[model samples]
Target: MPWGEIKDTAAERRMFQRRTLVMLGVAVLLLGVLIGRMYQLQVTEHDTYRTLSDKNRVQVQSVPPTRGLIYDRNGVLLAENRPVFSVTLVPERVAGMDATLEKLQQLLSISEEDLDRFRRRLREPRRPYQELPLRYDLTEGEIARLAVHRHELPGVEVAAELVRYYPHGELTAHALGYVGRINRQELQRIDPVNYAGSNYIGKTGIEAFYEEVLHGKVGYQHVETNARGRTLRVLERQNPVPGEDLQLHLDIRLQQLAHELLDGRRGAIVAIDPNTGGLLALASVPGFDANLFVTGIGVQAYRELRDSHDKPLFNRALGGQYPPASTVKPMMAIAALDSGVIGRHETIWDPGYFQLTKGGHRYRDWKRGGHGWVDLIKAVAESCDTYFYDVAVRMGVDVIHEYLDQFGFGRNDALDVRGARSGLLPSPDWKRGAHSQPWYPGDTVNMGIGQGFMLATPLQLATATAVIANDGVWRQPRLLKDVVGDTPLDEVLPKATRDNVILKNPDDWNFVTKSMIEVMHGRRGSARRASVGASYTMAGKSGTAQVFSLGQDEEYNAEEIEERLRDHALFVGFAPVVDPQIVVSVIIENGGGGSSAAAPVVRALFDAWLEGFADEETGAELAAAGSAGESSG
Candidate 1:
């Protein structure tokens, strides 16, 4: 028993000793490995670990600044920013995206379009932890619903953002333009560095023209984050500088008045202050709501606007190209008088129609019975087509082209607002370049009476009328009056003066101006019907542009024509003849006669504008008379 027990005890002791050694060796090896790893991380790879740790704890995010406001001359707000609520999501923090979306759909009513947009945004290669916009312009009900069940929705949050808004709605849509969400096309055009925080950009008009001024400088903030990459606190922030406010040259009162006068008609009216390049009113009828474009117009609404028959999206004032018609008469008369093609008192026999000797094409007058023998002054006053036809042929196409071009015709005016179309001032070179054709005298005769290849934008016609009103001192038409803020008015470069045809004889200008006055004030004037009881005299010309070509012997029967096929009506005029304050150009689509359709609109505009001054003068006169009577008593 003693010998066996001794052997078992020795074996047991030996086994215990081996087990203890193995356990100690394993512990030592683990300690060595852990120490080596600690050295590698703390010393050798210090920068890498530090950066990773910093990334987890601190984040630098962009903060967008408030866009500046746009106002009319009278301090009426045109374009502004309003607070909007949106639903945002961080993709990295969202677990099981499809499940979350399904849950959200149950909790809140989500549209297919909204889901599509959300999925599209998630697919973008943005920072995983950065918040991305999911749904914008959320209703109060949606916001309230989300708030009540916010704890159930991880990675989803409601955020307040400043959104662009147009207060005047459709009235100033084209002129003021509107801001829209940044798209791929816009991103490519914008400066990547500066636009890092910007989500909206100006798409057209003054907004596009002054993007740099309207869009403020971007800012940054240092933020703290939690383990889930959600923002904990904003550690540091640099306040953003707001964009410079713009005061436009447009008068809201006049603009509203002009827009009201246009009513439901599809047309354009542009009025300019003759002294300053300031545009008083720019009215394009059937305008769409600019607010629709601010966020993103739905496909249905956008398609409707794009396909509408009246073309609400179209900017008729600046972009619609139409034949100047007889509105070009005043300008042509100026050209004729200045070129010595016709004397003011010289008479041309109009036998109902003008026959081109070479082509034998008889261009008829508005008056079928003919204006008979008409002098230069009388021709302009009556808008005698045969007389202008005779003068145009005598003056030649080259002279007409050169003179009209000088008056901002056939070329862009470089207006403050963007998208100005250069009207066609056809010439020999233009015909050759544009249509690869030779110039003909028949073409000259047609162009002479604002027909043929002659086309003009409402803006061009308005600006030309302004030049005549200013007696040939052409100022570049401007929409911006001043940039308010620390930026001085001098900071904006003064618009360069453009001189076209300078009147060699001042008497020629006076003669043409006087004749235009007679057009509204004369006994037999075409626009005489509208001139009835006008407080101030208006100098204007009426034009009827044919929608379809007539045969040599065919008469223009506006009554028999369909409304769409009727003649386009046009009128251009300046008020108070001697001291011209406002110059206007009006065009009525498919409206039979300029006197009947277009001139009346201008008369209303003139009445509206003059009525303000008349009111002020009347008030002053009554006050003065009361004081005088009191003193006399």
Candidate 2:
């Protein structure tokens, strides 16, 4: 007062001092807390914070391995990989998926299919931050457009990848198969870690069968990325291992020749190396382009293929089932001889037909006037149905089933042949099971000629013929020849399923083989005309399988029947009788006669293989073998 006159000086001084001290103490405490917090963040939690920071700037990305190249035995490339650019997006990185996809569509002109496929993939479970493809095979214009808009669109990327290519296109379609986009089903089956970045998977044929060997190991890389998720640089990389290259036993030249031989017809041709059981050529006419399937085939293109009457998508070589017809006669003869039902020299009198009783229903022979008194060799050469019918009734169905089963009928158990159908071999048990009917004597007669309930795939026919060529040594038919790397084929692939067809008399093989040769060289041989002027010896059997049974008094006239209802002409043979090199099976659908339509085609194959493709020494050696075999016989 008066300024301090009326004030209590001591008390005011003490309170002032206390307040200052209290304020100072509080300040010191706050500062200490700040310092402690700073130390905790910058020292104790340093590693954790630093790791979190680095995660925002860096990423570990999967690198897909290059798919293996598939080549023919002659080093002709069948399947390869070509580089392509595609558009992709990572869902987690996008702010608004619907808006981003809309903007992408506007910028890239994306189709409804692409949108649908993208949405479908979005619904599937995937690794966090993994990029999903929206469009494939982007053009330069589209890439440029996307690049200009990339900054505005988060998670969008233009990635370059390798897609599968088939050089031969439609020619090797069924044989080599094709790769396709990994669908939902495939995604479930595939190893997620191994196929993290893979988009394509084998869909069929060799591609499907060897998918594991063809799809190599996955690799990873540490990548530095900008805020917009654009990869600035690769920080560290672990290169992926490429898949094992495959060298198949398929010969492109032989394959092309077979295609040419079966041109303009619905048929299949199967050629095998008798010595190795390797498939040289497997041709199914009217094949489609395999390349279309590599990058997700269009709806229209796939529908066309799926609906076509020609069945271009079908693998006729491995799947087409037809009666082996007289082509099975040689095997039947072996069966008869081994079972002691008939001798090599046993004769049966044919009066144009066979009868179970003296006045029973007649099973007419193809030849109107009968082959007269015919032995086993004559019966096989002339294709005398009556002889086989007589023996079939005598031997019964049980014996026939047992013998044919030994020859690989009623089963498609080859190690490398995928999706091959087992043809039916009828027996008492089978007839009872399948049709609820007992096996009849007439059924046995029909089985004798490879008819009635008997059905055989072209592959089985070729394999059986190959077994015959190998002198009853059964080696499983295979397409894989070698793995083009340090690994041996045996280590990489499953061992071939094999067995020997034991015969009572081993010489019986020689007898059947010799008789088959006569069918090509004899005076009255059914297929003799097909062998005119041949330098090499070819043992063959021709057969005609009826599409529909004829009336007892009616003869088969091709002009009267519909084209599709005509007989299926068939022929099976091996060249160089003494040392068989190739065994061929041909089936011409709806062809009138086997001798005329199918046998000539087989002869042409023989000429192309033995003369056109064979070396001079090979021809000479085969010629000498033929001469020696003829003279001895």
Misplaced by over 4 Å in model 1 are 1-48, 120-131, 489-497, 613-633
Candidate 2 stretches greater than 4 Å from native: 1-5, 8-17, 613-633
Model 2 lDDT vs. the true structure? 0.85
Best by lDDT: 2
- How far residue 160's Cα lies from its native spot in candidate 2, in Å, is 0.7
Global lDDT of model 1: 0.81
Q: What is the lDDT of residue 579 in candidate 1?
A: 85
RMSD of each: 6.8, 4.4
CA lDDT, every prediction?
Answer: 0.81, 0.85
Clashing pairs in 2: none
Write the residue-wise lDDT of candidate 1 on 1-633 in tens digits: 578755788789999999999999999999999999999999999999998998889987878888999999989999989999988887777877888788788867777877887777677654335567767888999999999987777888888889999988999998888888777677777777567677789988888888888887888898998866667899999877788999998988778767766667788989988888788888899899999988677777899999999999899999999988888888898899888888778898988788877467677776778888999777877788889888888989989988998899988875576888997888898789989999988888888789998999999998998888888887888898899888886666356657655887977777788888877888777777667777788898888887788887776766788888888888899897868888888887886677776776777677667777344333322312221000000
